[model samples]
Target: MKTFGIMTLNFESEALYIDGIAALSQSCGMECFHFLPSSINPLTQQVQGRRYSAIEQRWFDDEFPIPVLIYDRCFYGDDEHSKQCIPIVSWLKSRNDITFLGFGLPNKLELYGTLTTSRLAPYLPHSQSIKDCSEVVSALTKQKKIIIKPINGSQGYGIYYLKKNDKTIHVKTEKNKKIISRIFPNETKLCQWLQPLINFRPYLLQPYLELSNAASKPFDIRILLQKDEQGVWVERGKGIRIGNTGGILSNLSAGGSVIDFSTWSSSLPPAGKEYICSELNFIITNLPYILEREISPLFEIGIDIGVAKNGALWILDVNSKPGRKVVLQTDPDLKETLFLAPLLYGKYLSQSENKERKSNYEKTLYH
Candidate 1:
């Protein structure tokens, strides 16, 4: 069996998500080891329940052998104390023998730009990160109604939608709303109110798709994609997430309810359904290829798509490490399979090695 090494943050016992992935890896014939940075002592060079020293500031499991594959699952920056093992991760990738999965070494800005320029662009909502408030206001005015999301936000957080009228712009949040009047008929006061929010973080301005239910809650579709052993892209599952009434975002973390895409699609008109399917297909097929060619290395992607009142489909966002909640909810049976594909691929390679060994043994006997 191939050994797989995973470098991740300290996941609490309550974090069933991480546990699920670990279990799946083990089932796929990969001996998985999770290195939690928080539990490590810099002075002792040891983690809880283990005795090991850092060689040139890298932690290695003294009991287990060197890993055949290393999955870089750290979400935070490389410099954070919680991510101090990043240098160790880099060292692993430096070795020619170990295969590194997820985030082939790149800076943050370069990685973002790579994804934004790739096939993933279509799945991502139209966004412009501008420091100039004037340019952002102009873009918002053209759209009439638009949403501003933090470029690095997750789980429907830090999303604001602004609806503009003649002289007033109404800013709606997930919890409340604020109305601001245009101070100067020419200058956009709305931008001034938004400037503070933009801060150091990049903000994305996207046209708000009027996706609403009878109760007026906006909803969106979440599609999970994964690669099988043969490197075929497979749609693991799809779900419709309905946001809280009057909410600007639809995320489970934001109190959204997940529903089957079939149920939601059936509720829509035939034309709307056709439009959505066509747009989704375009996003899934063309977008991945585009991202692979244009962006840095990326093997998997999750797409959030919304259908407007006018029956037009819009790409909401593209997530590199999209949650697997929907996959488990929709098809629990495939959860292990989908999540362990990479590990399973490693296992298959190991099996091939065994076959080669047996063939050599048989040849020796025949001779």
Candidate 2:
């Protein structure tokens, strides 16, 4: 039987999800192991990890050869340990003998720049890097309301909504599950407060579109698309994330709630409903092709799309290592299939006679 490995940053992280995949791997006639990139031996090409036995319901002490296929779940950070493991993981990704499920996507700004040049440009908000404080003043003067987000941030952290009044700048953000508000007397004050943040990390600025409902809750459509065993892209599920009333973000991590996509879409008027369905269908059909051609062969992606009050659709974000909460909450019946996807894809990669392994880990975009 082929050995499938689940690699992560910490060994103890995602305990339940890890075991669920391991249990299903045994049922699918594959041996499952869990390990870290630091566990790999550079000289011997061996891995020191724990193998799972479904019958025993526990990980047993064992050593094994390098896995035939890897399901990478590593979320890189800026710590020394995380920094140390990045090169190790990159080296593993560079090997032609080992295959990964998804090689991950580039940072937010890179993704946005790529999509802006594609057919989706009409749906993209005008964005630019925060190179000068004057740029923010210029964008605010033109658009009235603008948003600033870290180029590499996730889970809605460090996102600020800035609305330009005649002489004051109003800022709102979610911090520690609470709404944080501040008002700057003028552009000079706003720039003073923002200069430190800009120096802290790189940020991308976009004109903020109003996406709240009648109840004042912000929302966006979260869609999950995954490749099946036959190497075809399939929509697993999509749902609506309604955030806190008057909040700036709709991320579940930022205290947002889920609503079934069908129910939400059905509540719309005929024209609104028609617009959403048509545009979403167009995106779902073409997005996978876009990523594969421009990025890499991905096993799954989570797409965040926001619809404006005027019925305009905008692609907010794209993630290669997307969460399952949106799909699992809306469609509980898809639970079994969701857990089975990685293993089935791994098996397909192992059984195929063609050696189509990846050496490039989507690194060219950084330049």
Task: State each model's CA lDDT, in order.
Answer: 0.60, 0.85
What tens digits encode model 1's per-residue C-alpha lDDT throughout 1-367? 5666655555442245444555666456665655554544546644442212223322334544455665556554324663465555444444556554443323223334556756555444565665767766787568878877765566666677767668766776663332222333434566666677777567677777788877898788899876556555778889888887777767877777788888778987897788788788877877656544544334356778787776667666666566777656766787566557657555544444322111111111000
Please give the range of 10 consecutive residues that has the lowest summed lDDT in model 1.
358-367
Local error of candidate 2 at 59, Å?
1.8
C-alpha positional error of residue 25 in candidate 1 after TM-score superposition, expressed in Å? 4.0
| Tens digits of lDDT, candidate 2, 1-367 | 8889998888887777788889899877789999888888888878888999888888986788889788888877657777777788777778787888878777888878778777878878877899778899999998899999988877788999999888889999998779999999999988888988898789999889889988999999999999898778899999999999989999999989999999999999988899899999998898878877877678888999999988899988888888889888998888789889999888877777756645258452221
The number of the candidate with the highest lDDT is 2
TM-score of each: 0.73, 0.94
Supply candidate 1's per-residue lDDT for 98. 58
- Model 1, position 246, has a per-residue lDDT of 74
Per-model clash counts, in order, read 4, 0
Report model 1's TM-score to 2 decimal places: 0.73
